[model samples]
Target: MLVKNISVVAAFVASVCIMPAQAQNNTIVVKANQLKADIQPTMWGVFFEDINMSADGGIYAELVKNRSFEFLKPLAGWTFKGKERKEGDLLILNRQDKQTNNPRFIQVNPNHTAKGDFGIINEGFRGMGIKQGLRYDFSMLYRQPAAGVKVHVELLNAKNEVIGKTTISPVATGKEWRKLEASLEATATEPKGTLAVWFEGSGQMDLDMISLFPGDTWKGRKGGMRADMVQMLADLKPGFLRFPGGCIVEGYDLSQRYQWKKTIGPIEERQLLINRWNFEFAHRPTPDYFQTFGLGFFEYFQLAEDIGAEPLPILNCGMACQFNTAEMVPLDQLDPYVQDALDLIEFANGDASTKWGKVRAQMGHPEPFNLKLLGIGNENWGPQYIDRLQVFTKAIKEKYPKMQLITSAGTDPDGERFDYLNGQLRKMNADIIDEHYYRRPEWFLQNAARYDNYDRNGSKVFAGEYAAQSDKTVSIHNKNNWRAALAEASFMTGLERNADVVVMASYAPLFAHVDGWQWTPDMIWIDNLHVVGTPNYYVQKMFSTNRGTHIVPILKNNAPLAGQDSLYASASVDKTTNELIIKLVNVSANGLQQEIKLDGVSKLSGNARHYVMKASGLDVENSLKEPLAIVPVEEQWKASGKSLKVNLAPHSVNVIRVKHLDLVSFKKAGKME
Candidate 1:
């Protein structure tokens, strides 16, 4: 009865095919038996950077802002009350000559503060979101002259009512800085809380690296990430996590390049630096943006492990950002940068007894992170890039020969610079060449067959960063709309079809804050206490979650379905699940029906499911108020015999999953066609 009902439903589905003046309903025949290539688990991933408050106010669970006295405006987030202002009274001293790495510290004038209790209040990052009964860890570096100065810390709510308090008095009289720690247990929950530090009966207290962290962070680590934010990433089930940056690795200048060593070690000692995104976008300037490195390399590795993803950390390759300074380090001085790469490997994979491994062990993860692939540089161009790349390739091969390396194809996916680098890297037999593209939705739809003609013998491809720009490149008016995600999904069918050539792909600038973002069309958006997955996020999620082991061809009239009547499709058979997974996209403005005939399988279970993501229009988008606006809708699909019919909704992405009957049943019905 079920088979009969499925057959009737399939006939109805096929009969509904209609033709319009603009386009006709197409028939997509899936050759389930014709196997293509295997899909790599690392095909889908995430690219993260510290841009747009992505780390401090976005992910890292440190509630206090400007915890370190390193921002250009030293006390940008702090307000002082009952304070005397005079020359040398409140000073920011830099010990650059001695403590070269950490140069800034606050020096309060003792003579001027003797009259009253001086208080410093931090407004936090858009005000702290404190929960009732939660504990907050507070720590700071202090250089005291005597035991007379008592620092009282208090957490205050909107009404200026203190919910928690702690006191710290420096007992020693010396110039050397000492670390002090205290904990506060909030009596009531307050979404917006402020921290106040009052200096009473003071002499002189020099402070730097002041910080506060919530106790309930991911994995309960003292200075770890926000549980909710990390949970969202974990839920996506990404295969790999590309860390540190897109442009941050190559700084505005070589002097400001991301130095991994400076990022590790004690939080107090991890020197703060200005984030490149601080002023990169003049139209959307964020002057308060800075990198404290609290969520540094070690944390990145830990995050990758926590989310069950491979860590792909790209390093500085003797070149700064080409768009800016195009600074280069001499060949002789390049050894340090090269050595950093070698040490990074040891830190990630070497035994505990090793030097760098010991530092990693001290950071709470003694076990190796199972380092595999390493990217040399990010989006560098010209002969200058190749020259330095050759040096790194030779050195890394001589040492860790088995370690797989990824090389960049400049700032574009094509043109002179990209063509030259691709040729050179291919000649070098580079393990994988990274490619990037940020194009219009129409461009994505047109280039759905971009890799169809790629040389199979050349270096493999890693689509390192990409997103469909809805408006224009770097446009402030761009959006993460349905049209962009739909186009990306259509292009992804081609990437899956050529899985043998493209090994990894991920969306860039994985996160953005609604109020603090500099980049548009990001994958995920977050606020202080909430996060919303854009339409693009769900599109990536669907493909990643249902990734099949082997690709299968879904053709029409013996031709690959690439924009045939505005219909795009790709099919794959999962070896583990013994199911046929077909992906389809309808870019047309009208609904269409397709008849997919399974050639190799005689019988498929009538029970199947269809997952469809559709919207009313191309411009539809998800908002914080309605986060699920563009999410998928799932329902059981009816099918029978070797022919299955499906109706494609207008401007939608669909995945149909069906189980294949065993060999015994298939052989029994061999002649039944």
Candidate 2:
């Protein structure tokens, strides 16, 4: 039976004062017979991976081409001899002599061969997983010796079958390095593999700085981010963006850290660095490989501006340990990093007269950027973090006092340390306490109401990192876990109920490029070419985009169904359109058909717009092959009198928009009658 609002409110008030408060019995019902609400339009926000470009990492966006032929053997090798390391994998060779001079080219006879095989493998290729039928522009530097060289470039499928092949001949006596470019089309049959440059029957050849990219024709720009990729993220309508993070900012030491200055400016000068995460996982020797900061700080700011999102930049706190804990720097030695923070703020928000501000203007944006929030560090904690926070907080408060400061609390399961850290931050008057949660789905579901007991007077909360961990077999099969959905919904409800204290929130480790992921269960997963938004992405979108400025008291009728513990509803008025938006969540296994009757609102005579996110199974996800396996669908609703009955699917989120009728029209019609 549909429980009306008027009766539910009386029941809530009666239950509240008369009995002990419990999760199951905490239902509220309105007393008014008439129902009305003013719904407001919601804003959407998206997080961009910045690895090749910024912190959000993937090959397509990562700007620097790290693995070239810099490590190739000299004349002892078939292709070239005496390779001088350029950037990451870029190697330059001299062609003057073989013994005395470095041999840039090698003569490959019928029988004579080099010690190792020299052919393009997976190395040095970006966006290898790009979809077929897409156009990509390829560029590289090659020099020919006195004798010309012939090379065959083939796009091979996963099975090593050549899907597309092209041959190129370098002109004789090509001494200096010359730029060679070609446009390649990704065919429909092109399996997921590398576009290999095979040097067979080579006379003399030297190559450096090879790059291939999808064409920029889609957006009319020459080159940069893929247009379709950017458009997909833009459609999500992200509200805020947290830049350069998740262990990316917290480097081994001060030198290896992601310095904003190095990444800015032209691509030629930007030195590439080995990602700490990649280096650790690959077990490579050289950890501090220089990173070409091609997509620098300016790009991050520009991206935020372009997408109309609030920029949230994270700075390095004073922990020198690489993935381990370290002692904080002495107060005297901490000045440089602190100054770097100050300068970054100036670069983002200062006028032209300021130092970095002028540099920003020189970069084409004379106007100061809007710097809303600044995070202290990624996930390091302890006395060192606290000490560093003390220094950073003091300086930032003195300079940009209005800017919100966030500090990370260690991710300990007990949450005791987290609680203590929050207390410390509140004592220090920190603006936001960054807490990370990564637990099993069941844990999240059980603790969904954990935040209900939070101290309202304390600093705001930000769930910096969160996602369920799954085994390899389960992820590959594309199975949905109900535990995750339930946890997400429950946690989201806590955030909404405490929205006043939790002003800004975001899920961590947002994207994991198919091969690029070190952690499992990311919100969004993408390969070099194809992408998929995980179930968590949809859950986040539903809550974030439907949020309203003001929340109304919600009343529910009926005893709590066993196993279906709680229900929540909130209402808000859109001042601009005078429409009422109702967000209802039914955390139950059975569908809820409830009668909603709002009070203190009138003239409600309009069709309702309903948006629901549901799936046949809880574990369903959208993949690159099929993006619409699970998506939101909209429908129209007809209201009957002052009460509206809604049938909410089990374990589903529903947003209803009701446009309040105009009183003037009703008055005129009454007079005419």
Candidate 3:
């Protein structure tokens, strides 16, 4: 009769249907299933630096030269005393000398006989489009005959109006070069402008290696990415990464685009481009700028390999109307774009025989990279986009039939855009469809079940960009409210439930330095002084870290609990250690105390490991000043006989691991005891 009762329970679980809550009493009972746990790596994606903007004199993503100065142009009253050399047709700056005679002052002097009119006119730092309210760290080397030089700095807006001004007193010594630094705060009154480094006030000073940066702090523990940053990300054990995106792919023009080729090789040849958010311009006449592709396609692919992640590269889509989208290249003129696609593949999976593949080998690795997925473009739609996508799809499929292709269609839930594009993609046999979402926390929670009924027969899904808003201003120190935590948790549960369809997912705008951020409420916020991970980052880590490879069926028996709206459970058994891993999610405002009874297992033994995620309140958040306001904690659980009872805090997620004792012989153990 007991066995018969268990069979009936299994049948009931198979027929369980999910429905919306009518009343508050929503509860479910779960029965353990005997299945092996399949452990897989976690998926955690972030954006690497894109070379679309210039931060300081040194290009972003490019290597910093220890001591050197690259002249942009000749100043108004300055003449080049040295010969200019031409490498090919390009004019190269070699070396120039300034002839001045009025008692050349090496350092600044408050009371001097002359006004130091011999200063280099226009021989100053140019802005790379820095805007107001953003923070930046500016550093340079000042060498003079004596110390005590007053360096004047000015930030000029696009209108040529001085928006910010500051003066620094250099710690001078007459004998050697001294390092000087000043932190600049962009003001609301300052529009997008250029930065100028003025060495005025009666001093003959030699300036070199002028560096400016935005963000609260540097990324790696040391100044640059030597080994610390790599170790930190590796410790997380992420499964997959979606490289190079979140508006960095969408440039203002073709000339300003992120050309992957330029970022490779040495740093000197790479040109710096204007940042889109900084509201600054390149040299004037036209807004077109150069990007020193220091962090190129190879680096992105290598980073994925180093971190044990599956690389998912996103290509440039058809041009936008604002940035001058190239007309659908006539079928005849499509060679260039098509060739680019081919080159990208070769670079990723080509052998030494191939051109780009040979380059990869020359870069140090002789083995071909494993690349199974390729994204057609960034966020794009419309008829023109569709047509261009078709061309790319045909070419890529013809070359590599087994390769997976991912495409983007606009995300308009209310309208038929996603549905319509989904249909088209299915018809064309696309492997995956990239979907993005950025909304308020309430909306995310309200639609947590949006993918529950998604067509299983359609292409796989990828949530490319989804973030809860905190602030719209440029400052990166803003904190994410507590409501966001609850909302994100609920939405993630939905993603986990639909893992079969949602094959891959990632959060957008992964990092922002307090001084140089264009967006707010990022996952990781850093400044020149410190770095902190947001509450959302921890939530993602906990969920991804505990995920198993395969899905198992669970049986729940609870009827209805007061103040509870939904209850769910998933379980798996680790083969190596013979431990049962169980995850329980309760989306209720009140706490839940339930007893889990395992009837079939007679060999169950050992302590249980439990991990929990919860918050003190709904509106709490971790600020720059206080980053660990909310995080996950681990504890042990007591198990007696075949039943385990545990208490779950309100609005909490819990994972428990129960060890087994099949390896221990009862008779032998009893004799020993």
Candidate 4:
């Protein structure tokens, strides 16, 4: 075949024969004139879960752990620093029969006690992240039965040296609990800092909901998300935000499943539940782990709005986690669960006059969230899930027909569970089917064409959660390395190529705390004072930011480049920006010279914006100390005669954007689309 007129790779040898492994075939042809499919707005997003201390001790900005003394071990995160006193001097009283939601409170009797003689220090979740000159706000529910009560607060570093100080005198003397708040500015910065409270000149005071937060929280909201953590999410410019999720939506038992109703309204009223991840590993016991619901449904919705992302909240169906309790509610008793789903839609998009919508307004969100997608379950399988889902589907559709429902394909991507659920959901004409995968890097590369032949008619696909496991699924040794990131980039090209079938996709297990993680290979890692976006995160950012308005075919030898010669490619044209955006993922460990032919092109900008990210080594990863070690490097490249001639670095994900002069001029002399 002669390429005198038709633009093709310079060295492109069209062959049906199978190329040897890692062969050097570096040819890619992007058909810019033809638009295949419209890329959905919610194509790439983020999946949030509360594992690895990502909630209570994480994104949730409450720095004080066990602030309400509600953990199983009532004083787990606290310590009595003063000399031991007689019985009844300090007591943990439970009002289980009265305040069922928050039944525990600490009572201190300091009759004739001098200042600094008795105090309790909170060893925040792995220590609080304190910044110099940043104000630390302290608040607690207190009741004083007598006069002469003063509370002293201090912030300490790792060496137990106080860097900040404040005092609170609860003058409200009565049996009823009253909320008291105060703020103190830190004089020094310490990533690992502690909060201490001294009971001084007190007759008797009962305290509950002892909380502290940094003044620099997101938007400076009193009790909002951590600024830096939320900034990482905002930086992604994500299409959607799936929240209050992962396994927490399907708890260890039905009795413990997340109840959205209980998570709304006042912070004091929000019921606290033991975190499902509490002490899962005997070797690394975290008995104090619990969900304070500080980051609940309202907060999740607000966060989505804050980050300019569509809210996709998954609710708890009538069944518990199949991997654990495998509990199910009788069909007759599933009414409440269905009602919860119906009410959530109202809470999100209902008018302010409606019941749940009023709750949204009362919570400072006067306008509706206008949520369009909702899921009933997360990773559940079997007929039990299907049955419960049937009820939920009927109810939600009847109430809000326009609302798109996401049905689960279960935990395994290709097991009997997935096949059965996938078949049933399609038969039911489900709007979207959620699929999850956590496999080796090779699996990702091999399955680069996963949705190539997926039916474009009925139920669309939602790659709800996926990660290329560096080791094995659920293995603590798995790392967020460059190899895994490259594989994911390769796989993602298929998702972009098949934009007609897969409407939504996201990377799973969004965050992990370096000191308190139970899961590895998270998109982002955080510690007391820092946030690190992994190489995988950079890949996501590169693709998402460059995601064009519509899909365009980028083929090699008239075939989609899916792992051939370890090169994967997808092309799109951004109608809004009048630019041709093409992504190339090179999996080889050695650099390769590549020629990209822009078929049916005439005139274009001389220089194109190029974003290239390459790992120094397969096993190398970004860390707290070196956050930008493997980040994308944005540069410019000059094109030659409407074609790009560039060298793709080994294990690199490259994005090239060429500005078109006009729709007509960018194509062949006689061609016009």
| Model 4, C-alpha of 419: deviation from truth (Å) | 1.4
lDDT of each: 0.83, 0.56, 0.54, 0.86
Superior by lDDT: candidate 2 or candidate 4: 4
Per-residue lDDT of candidate 4, residues 1-673 (tens digit)? 2222111111111212223445555667877877788899899999998898998899999999999988888998888877667688889999988999899999988866677788889989899999999999999999987768789999999999989999877786689889989999999999889999998875889999999999999999999889999999999889999988889898889888999999999999898998888855665567778999999999999999999899999999988888888888899999999999989999998888999999999999999999999998999998888998999988888878899999999997897888899999999999999999899887777777888778878799999999999899878899999878988998899999988889999998899999998887899999988999999999999988888988878888778877666578899898888889989987765576888888767656667988999876778899988899999888986655767887887778999899853444333212111
Ordered from best to worst lDDT, the candidate numbers read 4, 1, 2, 3
Q: Residues 184-211, candidate 3: write the lDDT tens digits.
A: 7766443234555544444445554445
lDDT of 1 by residue, 1-673 (tens): 2232233223222333223356443556766665677788898889998887889887998888887777888888988766555576568888888876678888765553442357778888777777789899998888876777777888889887889888877776597888888998988888678998877774778888778888889989887898878987898888899988889999999988999999898887788889899889899998888888989999999999999899999999999999999999988789999999999999999888999999999988989999898989889988888899999999988989998898999888889898899999999999999999998786677777778778776799999989999888899888999988988998898888788788899988788988789988899998766789999999998888888887777887677766666667788778788888889987766687787787777676767889999998778899989899999999896667877788888788999999754322111111101
Q: List the lowest-lDDT window of 10 residues for candidate 1.
A: 664-673
Candidate 3 Cα outliers beyond 4 Å, as residue runs: 1-28, 31-44, 47-232, 280-292, 321-332, 412-414, 470-479, 554-580, 585-587, 597-603, 640-643, 661-673
Strongest candidate by TM-score: 4
Name the candidate that leads on lDDT.
4
Alpha-carbon TM-score of each model against the true structure: 0.90, 0.76, 0.67, 0.95
Give the TM-score (vs. native) of candidate 3.
0.67
Deviation of model 4 at 199, angstroms: 1.7
Q: What 10-residue stretch in candidate 4 is worst by lDDT?
A: 4-13
Assess the local accuracy of residue 415 in candidate 4 as a C-alpha lDDT between 0 and 100: 74
lDDT of 2 by residue, 1-673 (tens): 1223223223322322212234333333432222222111212244333432223234234322342322232311112222232232223444444322113422222112222233544422233454567666666666566543455565667676666556665565457767777767766454255656655444555565455665653344433554545554555566676777756677766555666766666443454555655454442222222344545678767766776678878877766543553535677788888988898999998889989898899888999887868888777766667888998999989988898888887764346776677767888877877777766554454444455556656787776666554333214332334435544655665555445455666665666655545555666666655557766777777766666544444455532111133355555444456665666655555565666765554546879888887666555566777777776689997754555677877666677887763322111011000
Question: Total clashes, candidate 4?
Answer: 0
